[model samples]
Target chain A: MIRRDLVFEIGRTLIAIALALLLGFVIVLLVSEEPFNAFINFVAGPLTTTRRIGNWIEATIPLIFTGLAVCIAFQAGQFNIGAEGQLFFGAVTATIVALTFQLPMYLHVLVALLGAMVGGAIAGAIPGIMKARWGANELVSSLMLNYVFYRLGLYLINYHYRDSSAGAMVSYRLPETSWLQQFWPPTRVHWGLWVALAAILFSYLFLYRTRWGYALRMTGLNKDFAAYAGISVSAVIIYSQVISGAIAGLAGAADVLGLYRRFQWQQLPGYGFDGIIIAILARNHPLGVPIAALFLAYVRSGASIMSRMSDVSAEMVAIIQGIMILLVTAQAFLAKWRHRSVVREAKKHGLNA
Target chain B: MGSTLKGIFSVGFGYSMLRVTTPILFAALGAVVSEKAGAVNIGLEGLMLISGVTGVIVSAWTQSAWLGLLAGLVLAVLFALFMGYFHIKLGTDMVLAGIAMNVIASGGTVFALFVASGDRGISSSLASKVLPTVELPLINKIPVIGPILSGHNVLTYFALLAVVGVWYFLYRTPLGLRLRAVGESPDSADSVGISVSKMRFLALGISGFLAGFGGCHLSMGYVSWFSRDMTAGRGFIGLAASALGGVHPIGTAIASLFFGFADALSNYMQSLSIPSEFVQMIPYLATVAALGVFARRQMSRERKGKKQAGREVA
Candidate 1:
């Protein structure tokens, strides 16, 4: 059963990816006057330039962070959808630390990033605590909290931290010392890449090797059995949520320190939402997050190039992503392959058919 | 201070609250119906987006707001059908499919906008036909309360009428009973010779129509122009209303009204020294509060039921 399920998942993902790309190509053909050029650019653009590849990696850093966040909560059977808001809070908190105080460069950056994590953790806990205490649905609460976090962050920057000279609702610049050192010279890929890699490794180790991770996974697989075994399911839910929020916070901090000199968001940076797709593609495996994020980042960068080089809108890529997610999750999509794998597995076990 | 209180409690505030509830009520009604059919449609936000822009473009092209509304409703229903196909027939996770649909709506609408109006930000170039407000025939001539209730957008009245329609459909119809049965337990409904998928499809179809109307109300009835992400979080707010109100049409309307009042209050409070963002957080905050209360009540009830069952077993 397990082997069959795994086969179906992989098969479904491949088919979905192929379908999404094919559909994207069809749309490109219909819209862009130079359809062949547009398709070629979309397929091969990011790899053609080292700078573009670096940009893809840079984008992947934050994507993996949020993806890891979602993967943790989702694996624990918690739908903590408030990662988006937690991320916003993270950015806001990071901005405050960057703008408010003075410290040594490394200390300042570390403190600011920690501040982001704390902020995200706090925001993430609101829904978790509610679910633990009152049985309130995390999905609804977290989803609603997103608006609150976004609006509060917007108000904070627009009202208090507004850089008047910027001529837009943006925050004051961070100290130069607090800025992350760019690893890739030509592109903005910074130290966040290393931090993200560490985080992915940490999550994988935490999920597989740790007792708490086993308990969390058991709770997810069977709540009643986990409870009967004396596992505190509520604690697991809350812990996973808190950690998820921290990861989201780290994503926000990376966005501020690595990508932008100041908080310039007029809207929620959609990394948290994108993380949903990434986490699903990862199949709730923490180690799979970076790989999934890398593929998505590649497609995203390709779409950017295609839009810039030809007459296609970058927004069209969203359709591909949407279709990909829908198709990948469709249980009936690769049912035949799943059945065949099950039959093969039974034969290997030498069971009388 | 007294003047401030008076300003906050003015008839204008009440009127704005009603207007604010219009789209929410439509969307919430859809949420209630779909959820009652065992399919929770979280894609209302996306549906609203697609409908809002489609309504605007169609209204602009046809030079008739009514036709535009129709087109929007049709398109919205089509998207809902897509949701049903993916979730019900194709076996996609309902929540995940809904999320994907929202993404599709967010991006697809902008793509369409860029094609039709050559603008990604707003559909301002399209001279879209706006739905007109109508005076309540007899009520407009009445006293103070009458004027407050009268002269609303036609869709506002339709939103109220839809509550009645939803109530009647749920309680009075055999189909509604079957749909509710599916929600209560699909296996039980299937054993009773009811087609669970068909009922879900119909429920989703109805919900799509209502959500589509809600989207139409935003673009045609309220602003006449479609902006990207203009549905904001109202679709989710509608879902919250349904959950908070326990899937009852009247209860959902009341919940929607409370959020609507918050929305209007936020708009009004923007002129004050208080930041509008904090005020904008009210509807979302209210949703959280409502969820907490509902959860508490539900948990207590379950505890009582468990105790009773234990006693009976003993």
Candidate 2:
């Protein structure tokens, strides 16, 4: 039964991706002068160079973290979109630790990451507590907090952490001990890869093996049922959000320490929002998140290459993402086929029995 | 202190507040209409963006602001209807669909902008027409009140009028009753022969219509040309306003004004030597704080009501 369910889930996602890509190709044909070239580059350009492959891997790291974060929250049935704010807050906290702390290399990295998690957890707690305690709409409140933290981060960077000699409104460079060592020489990929893997593994175990995870899944499946079953639904809501925020915060820290020398992000890094698409594609499963993140990262990197090589812009991937999300989530999209397959399987099992 | 007082008490400040409030008011009213029909239009932000850009491009191409307004409204309604089909007919989750719509709008508008004009950031190349501002005949003669109340963009008046229009329609009209009935209980409404899907579609259509006005006001009256993400978070702010107002027209309007005041304060704070980033953060922070307070009050009130009901039953 589980195997059949997995097959259907995979089948639906694959079909949705294929259809979205096909539509994207049509859009390219309509808009681009060199449609064939653009589409080719968009599909195969990342494979052409080792450096480009590095770009894909580097991109995939943050997506995995955020995808896991979003998966956890969604599994709890909370639409806490404040991952964006949590990410920004986490990044800033990490930057602060990186700039100020005087520890050994690994210890410094550990402390910074912990700081980011705390920052993100606190950021996540606000909207979570509001919703769990007072029944506030988590979606709107999270979005509001995103803007607030983004601006607050900007203010902090501008006033306290500004590298006066640097060109833009950005923070000072991190200490040398704080930088995550690059694991791949040709690429900028760092220790964050292992960290992300650990996160995925940890998330999977936490969701599948833990009592709290059971309560979270129960709450997501049916809140009233969960409440009747003696689960503390409110506690589940708050902690799920907190855990999600901490993961997202970890992504922000990993991204900054692994990639850049200086805190150069002038705007909200949009990984949190992209995480939503990744989570949806992954069916909100931690085990599925890495695969989904890889797919998205590949497509995104390909689009960038396409933009560089052809007339089409990188924004085309957003259209594909949007269409894919809608199609995959649509309950009626391939309902007839799914129903037939289910019936056929049942009949076969009945005959065998 | 004197400069701050002057900035706050001036007629120009009030006028600017009303100007900034127009899009938010339209969005709030749109949110209210859709919420009444038991559908939350989280796509109001994207809808506004789509219409805002449409207004700019169409007006520039046709050299007529009225034509642009018409096209914008038409396109917004069409998209809303499409969302209706996806959500109602295809059984997609409303929030997910709305998020998808937002993503599409964010990307699609920029694509269209680049195709129509060479620039990717702003529509400065296009000779887009701005909507005319109207000066009230008698009000224009009045002292401080005149400048604050008169000589505003035409859409500003429409937004004010829409508040009352929405109130009357939602309360007094039979169709409004049906929409509310559909929202209140779709099963009961369906049992009574009222089409739940149709009412929802109508609710979304009205939402799109009102949001369209907000969009037009942005590109036309708020600024002379369309810029990328000109609507910013106004759509979300409007949604918050609708929620804060308890989904009532009058209450929503008042809530929108409160947000508008925060927005205006942010703008004024830029002149007060505070960091621009901190000042800009005011409205967004205000939104979160306000939602917290509002939700707390509502929950407490519900608790009280439940206690009273239990006592009566006993």
Candidate 3:
């Protein structure tokens, strides 16, 4: 019965996704003069070359980490909108440590990654502690921290770790010793892809297989009940937040060490917000996070390639993502549509299951 | 000592502070109202961003500042209504709806700019129409208070007036009482014949209106043009101000003013050979510190109340 129910849910989800894509195509058609070309580019643009596939993987790495971050927190019943901030904090820490220290290549990379994790954990813990101890709303706290982290990161890049030769808000270059090895020559893709996959696998095991994961899930589902059952709800919430922050921090580290030679301060990247959409689309499930992340990355990569090849702006990708999130989270509307469709099909068949 | 005092008095920090505070005060007033009605309006950031863009676009197109302000408000209210339909009617999660609205506004505005002007952001053809500053002629003759209050943007005065207006509406009116009751306990309010959804929707609409106006002030009153993400994190700062102020209109206004002072001081200090990046960090760091203080105080108060109750029981 459980397996049947799972299959039914997955089938319904796929149908909803297809309907959403059809609606999005209609929107694109209405908005664009070259509708046919735009639609074709959106569908087949990223699959045209190996470089584009590499770009898709590159985009998916950070998203997978950030999406998993959001998933862990959401599964523990904590809203962590500060993953962007955590990302910045982690990047800054990784860059500083990578620049300041001298070590062998493998050890240097490991230490920098660890530094990022620590930075993210600290940034993420603030909201968790605030929510758990003082009843401060995590949503507001996390959002506020994003600005704090942005400014702090910018300050570090401009004043403390600035490379004057660059003539922009960029930090000193990490020695090649600290950089991640490229998995494929001539492409920016690196070992970070494997790390992201490992993270997703561990997240799934931690959330579903372990005792601590079970406790966290229970707390997320019903905090009062979990408390009554002698679970430390507060502890679980805090732990999940810290872990989520660490993952986001790792993403920041990967972006800097794997792709860029220097640590440049991005004004804002929307990675954290993208993580929120991914978490929502995944329904906060650990196993669903990578799938959602990959889907988003594919759209982003395709949009970039399409923009280069056609007149359609890359900004349309954001519009499609917004629509997807809007449709996915409005589960009641999807449920109603599913119910109507199922009934209509049954009537046509002249049978009820 | 006399020279230092004179220098302090001569510096226009007080005026600059008011200018800085206006946007945040308006946005916080909007947030307080929406949150009180049990709606988490995270889309305030998006609303402000779109309004900021619309205000600049309309003003530049029409050569009238008032038209810009009107356009911003109308657009914000429309978005709010759309969000209300999704959250209240369609039973969508408020936060998710808010996130969707933000994503659309941010990316949509950029795409519209690209299509219309061939530029990625801000219009090139039209010169932005900035709102005229108002100088209180006779009132300026008065001593200390006049200088502080007069010769400001017209919207700044309105923002101050809104603090009192919001306070009265939230505390003194019967509608206010009903709205509060609904926010505190929706089921009880529903049982008592109050339309919880209606009240919540109204609150969100009002919030959108105020947030939109706040965005107008950013473009028309302060910067005189819209840049990409011009509202920056002011919307989030306003939300923090509301929380730190205990969700009271007057308290929120005061908190916003304090933040504004910090912001203005930071800007001023940046000209004095201070690192620009570090100076920019001041307001954000201050916000985190202030919020930390506010949270701790609330925690202590709750503990005190519990202790008193325990002693009474014993």
lDDT tens string, model 3, A1-353?
45744665666556656776786677677767787888888888877778877888889889999999999998898877999999989999999889989999899999999999999999999989877777766887788788878877887777788888887768888899899878786578997888888889999999999999999999999999999999988789789899999999998998999998678766767789999988977878878888888888888877777677666677767667766776666656657656776788769788643
Which structure among the candidates has the greatest DockQ?
Answer: 1
Task: Find the 10 residues in a row with the least total lDDT in model 1 chain B.
Answer: B1-10
Off by over 4 Å in 1: A1-8, A344-353, B1-3
Candidate 3 segments whose C-alpha is farther than 4 A from its true place: A4-20, A337-353, B1-11, B142-148, B273-314
Per-residue lDDT tens digits of candidate 3, residues B79-129? 888888888887778888888888877876676656655566666654778
For TM-score, candidate 1 versus 3, the one ahead is 1
Please report, as a residue range, the 10-residue window in candidate 3 chain A with the lowest summed lDDT: A1-10
A143: Cα error in model 3, Å: 1.8
**Where does candidate 3 clash, by residue pair?**
none
lDDT, candidate 2, equals 0.90
lDDT of 2 by residue, B1-314 (tens): 68877998999999998988999999999999999999888889889989999999999999999999999999988888888889999998888888888888877788788778865758989999999999999988999999999999999999999999999999999999999999999999999999999999999999999999999999999999888778887888888888778899999999888878777877888777788787667667766887889889999999999999999999
Clashing pairs in 2: none
Model 1 per-residue lDDT tens digits across residues B21-98: 999999999999999998889999999999899989988889999898889999999999998999988899898989
Full-model lDDT for every candidate = 0.89, 0.90, 0.82
Off by over 4 Å in 2: A348-353, B301-314
Q: Relative to the unseen true structure, what is the C-alpha lDDT of residue A196 in candidate 1, on a scale of 0 to 100?
A: 95
